[model samples]
Target chain A: MFNLIRRDFIIQKRQLVMYVLLILFFVLLGRQDPAFIFLLASIIIPVNTIAYDEKPETNILMNSLPYTRNEIIASRFLGTIVFIILATGVTSVLMYVFNRPFTTTDIAISSSLALFLLSLYLPMSYIIKPGYSAPTALISFLVLAGIVPPIVSYLGERLTSVTDFLLNLPVPIFYTSALLLGIVFYGTSWGVTTFIYRRKAF
Target chain B: MENVVEFNNVTKRFKDFSVKNIDLQIQRGFVHGFIGANGAGKSTTIKMMMNLLQPDAGEVKVFGMDYKTHEKAIKERIGFVYDANVFFENLNLKDIKRIVAPAYKHWDNTLFTQYVEQFELPLNKSIKNFSKGMQMKASLAIALSHHAELIIMDEPTAGLDPIFRRELLGVLQELMLDGNRTIFFSTHITTDLNRIADYIAFINRGQLVFNDSIHDITENYALVKGRTEFLDRDTEKAFVHINRLSTGFEALTENVSSVKRTFGDSVVVEHATLEDIMFHLKGGLQHV
Candidate 1:
């Protein structure tokens, strides 16, 4: 199972430099939110790894190996967490070295959002046809980005009592709850992907 | 004889095609060649053996164990090669080996290095740059390095130059030097089987026609030729299918003796090659 996870790194060895450069590009150029930059850094590697894995040939190769379908999916979910931590750590160091300002809150929010985005993307990648999932994910992310804020704000304005109760919660507890919710979604996505993958025919 | 793989009443259905009720057994310590035309469910059967595609009905077993309970154990003992390159195309052979070698518990690096040298494969060159033959050699090298007891390949010799095809056959023949190894490979090229295959399993149009020894297949099936007048409703029972030309008629028969007995020296009977058998059988069995 570790071998399966390590496969992503080996496959993308040449692109490792590019990944670093991509993060640096964002860090150095755009005046984007530090949290958003961190989110991009966390997402680049795992999502790119999926792009390679979504191919039929890759699936055939992985399935033909001694690993079970459960083990394969486990590696992907576990590997996503591993890369999220590693990429976030690396980005933090880069931010520190550049003397940029980022708080623990920034790390918390970005990592949680990373988990949420990936939880949704991983299962959808398996469900969608190969060569199209990346675009589908991009389009859906854009659509959600455009529409979700308005919906959430509208609901917040309409449901004052619920919004007041949530807003009254302590900051640490709120962030912790957000992180916990991300974990729940991640776990459910893992189960869903494994189910879909087990029934899939090569 | 110990059976390395078995399929019992296995059926897989697709909207447009299906592999119907197949019962096949592959013995240990022999080379079994699966021969069929394009879209004949050869790959489907091979995929079921690998557990890539589960059967809609019935069971498939390997090494006397079912896949549901022993998927990893079964796969660990069996190595697979598909019709196309399944390795990451952009990665070189060495990196690919690094990724694949650790998956098996008994991967032999020395044996892998030997095959790499023997096949003249470049370690640093990306697989995308390799020729079809080289890509096949790469797959074979990995499949062999694991010390797998059963090596299952689907269309390994398709789209290769004749020389490389012969070379691949020679490599497979050498692998058979180990008395415990068994090879099951599918191919449309019937001639390759004549060189090394000890048993032949012929499938046509999603149905298994026969899975028998080369000696039995050759002994049972033959080509009979004579004037068209020799073929009658009663006499036609001897032949599986018949082709009538303006000059004469040539037919394939599973019973060589019946053909001789019915014609009484009027028709010439010749040993049918694998091609002849496949060609005649592909025309659909005649019911007389």
Candidate 2:
């Protein structure tokens, strides 16, 4: 299973340098939100790895190996978490080196959002066709980014009581709840992917 | 167990195609050639053997263990090469090795290096840049490095030049020298099988036509040519399929002894090549 996860790094070794530059590019631009930059950083590697894995040949190769279908799915889910942390660490250092002002809350929000988006994206990748999953993920991400803020704000304006209650909660508790919610979604997605992949004939 | 892989009453159905009621046992320490025409469930049967596809109705066992409980254990002892390039095409062979080697408990770096050298495979070039033969050689190198007891290849020599095909067969023949490794490879190339295969499992229209030793295949199947009138209703039953030529009637018969007994001096009986059997039987059991 670890070898399966490690496969992403070996496959993307050349792209690693480009990933670092991508984060640096966003940081130096000094225009996007630090949280958004962090989220982008966290999402890139794992998602790119999925794009590599979405190929039929890759699935055939992996399934033919000594790894079980469950283990293969497990590796992707766990590898996502691992890459999220590594990406966060690298993004934080870049922010610091560039003298950009960012808080730990930014990291918290970005990582949680990254987890949420990936939770939805991972299983969908399995459900979608091989050559199209990566594009579907990108479009879905863009659509969500465009619509989510307006929807949330509209709800915030309309549902005053619920908004008031959520707003009244302590900041730490709110962030913690969001992080816990991300974990739950991720775990569920993991199970769903394993189930889908098990029945799949490669 | 004497059989390294067994499929008992196994059946898999696609929307328009199916492999039905296949009961095959691949014995240990011999090369078993799986031959079928295109889209004749050759890849489907191979996929089922590798556990890439599960039978809808029956059980598939490898090395005396069911895939449900022993997928990893079963796969550990088996090596597979698909018809297409299954490795990451962008990565060089060395990186591919790094990814694949740790997946096996018995991966021998020296053996892999030796195969790389023997096959003249470039470790630094990306797999996409390799020729078809090189890609096959690379797949073969990885499949052999782990000392797997069963090596399953799907059309391993499909696109190679004749010389490379012969070389690949020679390598497979060399691997058989240990008398401990079993190979089950699916190929429509019957000539390849004639050189190295000990047992031949022929599938036609999703049915197991026969699973017999090479000796049995040669002894049982023959192509007989005689005058057209000689192939009447009673004698016609002896042939799997009969081709009525202008000059005479040529047919494939599984019952070679019956052909000799019935025809006597009237007909000429010749050894049926694998290609001849496949060609005739491809018409789907036309006894008449």
Candidate 3:
């Protein structure tokens, strides 16, 4: 699994420089709303790296290796965490350098959304051809971004008792439960992708 | 001899074509040549062995272990080269080696470096810049570097010049001197296999037409050329595959003794080449 992740890095070595520049540029431009930059920073590199694997030869080369299909899927899931951490670090440092006013809530919301987006799209990339998968992933992201908040607000307004009960909980407990849910969702996505990949023929 | 690879009633189906009930056993310590025309399931069969393609039915076993259950263990001991290069074309040789070498437990850096030097591959240049033959050499270098017991190649000789093709055969010959490693490669070029292959497995139209020792094929089949008038209607039916020409006709026949006895000095008989066998067996319109 580590070797697979290391391969992704080596293949993207040329794009690594560009990744850093793009992260810094987005953070500085969206200083007022750091979540947009944070989301973009976390997801761009992993998604782009996934796109590189669209070629049939890469699949043949990978299957020819000794790694199990589960390990390959595990690597992608683990690599997403790696990407999330790196993106967060770069974004936090740039925010500090620019004296941006961003709270912990900003980081949590954006990172969780980024993770959710990744968990959704990674399986799609494996199940479908990469050419269709990449554009579909982006389109799905746009649709989610457009619809999710309004739906959440509408539910909050309609179910005041449920929303109030949740808002009244202790901050730590609420955050911990959200984090647990995110982890479960990510783990489930990993298993699902592995299952799909194991059955797929190159 | 123990078998290195076996396909028992293996089947794969697509909308238009399918490989049905292929039963092949590749014994250890020999060079096996897989020959076929275009779209003859050579690549499909190889893919199933490598577990790149799933067999709809039956099983593929490598090193006596089921491929699906022991893919990692079996693949570690097997090296493969595709007809077209399978590496990232944008990456240089060094980068590819770094990515791939760690996947195999028995990878030998010194051996890989030697091949790199022998093949005259540039470490820093991207593979996209290399010629087709150079790319093939690079693929062979990687396949050979892992000390793998079984090497499976798909048309490794195509696109290569005659000089390199001969050189590659020499390298395969040297690998066989150990008398343990098994080589399986598919090719349209019969001359490449004529020199080194011990067994030949011929597939045509997704069916296994012939699988035998090169010696047996050479011993059993003969090319018979004679005047068109010499081939009576009854005699023409004896040929495995016959080709007609304006003045004379050539045919491949297993009953060479009978043909020789009947035609006598009117016909010329010679040992059949692999190309002659493949061409005649393909059974198409006349070729000039």
lDDT of 1 at A109: 80
Interface RMSD of each: 0.6, 0.6, 0.7
Give candidate 2's TM-score: 0.98
The lDDT of each candidate is: 0.92, 0.92, 0.89
Predicted complexes: DockQ each? 0.90, 0.90, 0.87
Off by over 4 Å in 2: B284-288
Candidate 2: fraction of native contacts reproduced? 0.87
TM-score of 1: 0.97
Error of 3 at A106 (Å): 1.7
For candidate 1, lDDT tens digit of each residue in B1-288?
A: 999999999999999999999999999999999998899899999999999999999999999999999988998999888879999999999999999999999899999999999999999999999999899999999999999999999999989999999989988988899999999999988889998999999999899999999999989999998999877899999999998888999899998887888898898999999999988989934421
- Give one digit per residue, the lDDT tens place, for model 2 in B133-162: 999999999999999999999999899999
- Model 3 chain A scores worst on lDDT over the 10 consecutive residues at A24-33
Two-way TM-score contest, 1 vs 3, winner? 1
Q: B89-187, model 3: which lDDT tens digit per residue?
A: 999999999999999999999999999999899999999999999999999999999999999999999989999999999989999998899999999
Best-to-worst order by TM-score is: 2, 1, 3
